[model samples]
Target: MTETDPVTAAPSGKGLDARLVVRRGSFRLDVELSAAPGDVVALLGPNGAGKTTALRALAGLTPLSEGGRLWLDGVRLDRTPPESRPVGVVFQDYLLFPHLSALDNIAFGPRCRGVPKAEARTQAAAWLERMGLAEFAGTRPRRLSGGQAQRVAVARALATRPRLLLLDEPLAALDARTRLDVRAQLRHHLADFEAVAVLVTHDPLDAMVLADRLVVVEDGRVVQEGGPSDIARGPRTDYIAQLVGLNLYRGEAEGHTVRLEAGPAITTTERLDGPVFVAFPPGAVTLHRDRPSGSSARNLWQCRVAGLETHGDQIRVDLTGELPLAADLTTVATAELGLRPGSSVWATVKAAQTHAYPA
Candidate 1:
């Protein structure tokens, strides 16, 4: 990708365009991101990968060291203060003031921007109604449920009429049930948002459901980015592979065979050569106690079970030997085989079940 100078990039566009570089001590964060109007972009990564720092820089809460510029809807905001920028941020914890009523919390943003008290209250009331929290308008943060508090937080950010919206781990604070309900509601709200929206999340499900595009960041840099389905189908890094639940291996290929540097040769149906990647789902793997005769599976390796754990209705067995693999078996099959940790087993997968692509 060609790197564009953020400072010189034109701001007269429909969305946000930014290049951020932040340095503190020896750590540095560098990333380029863009989103069109009505687009929700998600920054996803592991812990301490600078996803939050990137969001802060975009919100003007964190200053950039150098090579940083921010533009939204034809306005340059690199030098703007956090309060002055047309940006709104919803924090991970939904930092609602304990002393303020829900209506007051939503109205606070507009009031801070110099709107009259009556007008701010009116706008806040409308937002509460839109969020389906009109009845809870007078309730304090302490009385609201987790999902309600999150909605109030989102409403507070939207009440400011920001051109750029940022949400940092918006659903991380909710319980499983609350997260499911709130995620649906947030998706609806984001769909109606007219400006650019960017959210930081480590949850792959949240990112897939809420964002139009996924930006996978690691070690303060963007490693992969694309539509959610594309990223899910073709993960570029092991972190992403783990998120998508695929057993990915990088290897050198010659036609229909790939030789893993880690000491395994996988046969694939795809006609690929040079550097390649082969991936298969855990369910595609079958484990056996004794080598089977007259089996059609092209790939077989003897492995010792490293661990075993429940995966929903199935048991996931982690094996390490010639190849490190994860195999998902039914509970009945696992019980029949008496599978346990450190048990020697054979794993097999057909070439037709394995997917190979250029690395």
Candidate 2:
């Protein structure tokens, strides 16, 4: 079945409903998305996953292939020009006119929509004040800081009073410190917005923190769509599992044992009998210098260290052997074990540490 089949039974006519299809050479992007007013949906994926293509389709900046449809507030917009659509787009680079002041840059949108010059400036002033950039109204884009420039871009977008908002990597241009501050501010503004907002981003933390719902796209299709917490706890794809820092495997479960398709079996606390997925965090694994004996842990595997890297405050050990997986250890513990690329070690995990769910 198509992605929109389940949700298209009854169109509410008050929000966004779209089936974006774009074909480029051998690549085809077909993504279905629906959101109500006041809903913030994030399109998240790795590079070349069509996240940006979906965003462009929503903004009417890119034409859709045959059979594609786009509707916002019950209005057909697939054939409408970008300027005629009631959509506001904040590009990755802000795209502010360098010669225009902050106020003029924002006022330009309303003026183009035929609002009187004075009235458009008034609206721009209000947006600038709301965005806490009132004092920088006359400042040029080159003179403003990164966060300030982002706020101005958002204010400019809001000045148009669009029914749908599109942000393409809104924080991609900011520095690390500025990103945190802008992310918080952007979340607050999104919460207050009564329109449908779609954000395109590859950063997992940004998606989790700023969006009310996440749509994980890969290979031009929606791989998963759900709440951030749900996706974090039970990832369906290896890309998502790795993004959330979990070792995931598909297997068939019988009683308490899940036989992995790749070659090993994992003992889980849950009792099920069907195809299932097993997942555990790297922190749940313990590595020993030698084979552990008389251990209460139900799972053990002799592995060879394939690589080592620093992950935050812990050392992440990549292993390959009976069951390839990752384990996290402290630098001191790693030294004590004398672990290196070819070091042999035993890894153990209690049955309770693993989680299994239906495939």
Candidate 3:
């Protein structure tokens, strides 16, 4: 399914339905969003696209300008105060008090919600154990690692027993190595969360791994929304395509005939009709500075090498062809070809390496 596809959900009287309209100067955030119980939705976009603003609106940190509505399980909470709302928010920076222990940090929310101090601590302890942070419960935020702080933040949010959880760039603070481990850990916990979860992230990998659906906001408006795999497979906008960096094409496929809208047509292995998506990985494309003498490859486009960059030992050549595509070349091959920016080149991509699916 594509981003335009309608999502299905189990019948929930009112899980979380909100129309958030916030205006700052001339900039406006007008987003209509809904999620059923047990739904994990990710609000994904680049910086300054209002992903954070939307999350804040749902958490009641920002009031809407042109009227707003927020419902939680049939209850209209727009009129409710922030403290009275059942929403739980974990900020990008784990805002744990420096003086407080990891255990106390997790207990703070429940304590503020009127739970007994001892009971809240007990609850916090259980959550800490679940998050694999029980060993560091006595450690303060200043001493905790980035990944540890993130897990504690999550435990705090979940300890509130909220019907809706809001996570803002939960994994953005960790390094690459830590991110890999934390992402796996976070996915398991999110899967076990019984309530609706909405996370704001710019990382495609985080959105794809952590959530069931992605709601892409651009300049305060929802531009694309869909399941992660589908969006990865068929990106409608150039930004999405560039984010995933895949060669995307929109065309009609009848049986095995796949017509390219921008360049030469080709036959595909899939049988389809109407709107379809064709995608090819960057590594599948072969870059040549000269036009092919003779090749069995079905698709070849004469183009110019727009840019060259090194990814580890492999050189990634960006080609502006009859259609632009990214091609991966070895360091030795790049040195031998002497490929550079503005250099003429030819790109050859095998038909079997290209993939087509319903858009």
Candidate 4:
């Protein structure tokens, strides 16, 4: 599939439109992705899903077996080698040389690009200061903390002044506490980069927080691609639904009636026709011990509780019966009902709470 630039008539500034296909024995990876200038797109997937392989292909480290098309700002890049590609790559490990200081690490790229030694050092110094690493400019990678090393990696990548920036798990090596601080800073840096930035990450929060759109990969293929809110609200696959934590259903809608594939019908406030998506977060679901005789709840289910797990102060109950659905309950209510793995329960959901939209 070809992805034409959305800003077709306008001048190509800092954007990437590329198609890659890599095959090795039995495993094959095909990716067709594009982003506008200043757009951050996240390539998200589980481990060994070829997310990293896709990034390497963009960087010219991996050869494409079928398609080798690459364009940056309307300029053909398919013939460009790794060193020749106007791209910056930040590895998962923040692969800085142990022999070099932070300043030297950032300077290395520009120097190799034929910039004067004095100018390269000056450029590197500016980047280090911008990244708040001036104090550690003289420090080696072995001496820097995980967060510091990551910032240095980004600074080094940006020093190359690339038109297309590729980041592979930029924050994966950081500790949990460091990740929060780094995430905010990284977002700010990406916005001001004036270039198309692509990030590969397995963490859902990382993708959602850093990217404008997400291209979800599964088993070496692009399965889903859309805006962050769109992906979160209507995850197409079970893996995606669990990643974003939303209940998703596929059904045909006529007016307000939605017939589920699993033999349960739901009525919603939304008015739509044809194939549609109905979604509700687990927290929106409420549980009851018994179905009310004349209840206001539009949707009711007599389900058996299959499992209960504590999620902080809330209890998440897994149920099976008419339809398998997850519901969130308070710890107090769970104990009040003496809820267990095999307890009988009733689930009530309001039509207004459920969202129904065209698929």
Tens digits of per-residue lDDT for model 4, 224-334: 999999898778877788789877887899888899877688889998889887888888777778777777878888899999998767998998988688888899988
For residues 1-359, write the lDDT of model 1, one tens digit per residue.
23355486576657888888999887889999999989999999999899999999998889988788788887888888888998889999999999999999999999999999999999999999999999998999999999999999999999998999999999999999999999999999999999999999999999999999999999999999999999988888899988988899999999999999787899999988899888899999998999978789999999999999999789999999999989999999999989999899999999999999889
Which regions in candidate 2 have their CA more than 4 angstroms from the true location?
1-10
Please report, in order, the local distance difference test score of every candidate based on alpha carbons: 0.93, 0.93, 0.84, 0.87
Which segments of model 3 are wrong by more than 4 Å?
1-14, 250-277, 355-359
Stretches of candidate 4 exceeding 4 Å from the true structure:
1-14
User: Best candidate, TM-score-wise?
Assistant: 1
Error of 1 at 97 (Å): 1.1
lDDT of 3 at 42: 95
- Supply the global lDDT for candidate 1: 0.93
lDDT of residue 85 for candidate 4:
85
Per-candidate total of colliding backbone pairs:
1, 0, 0, 0
Q: 1 or 2: which has the higher TM-score?
A: 1
On the 0 to 100 scale, the lDDT of residue 14 in model 3 is 53
Regions of candidate 1 where Cα sits further than 4 Å from its true position: 1-6, 9-12
* Residue 209 of model 1, lDDT score: 98
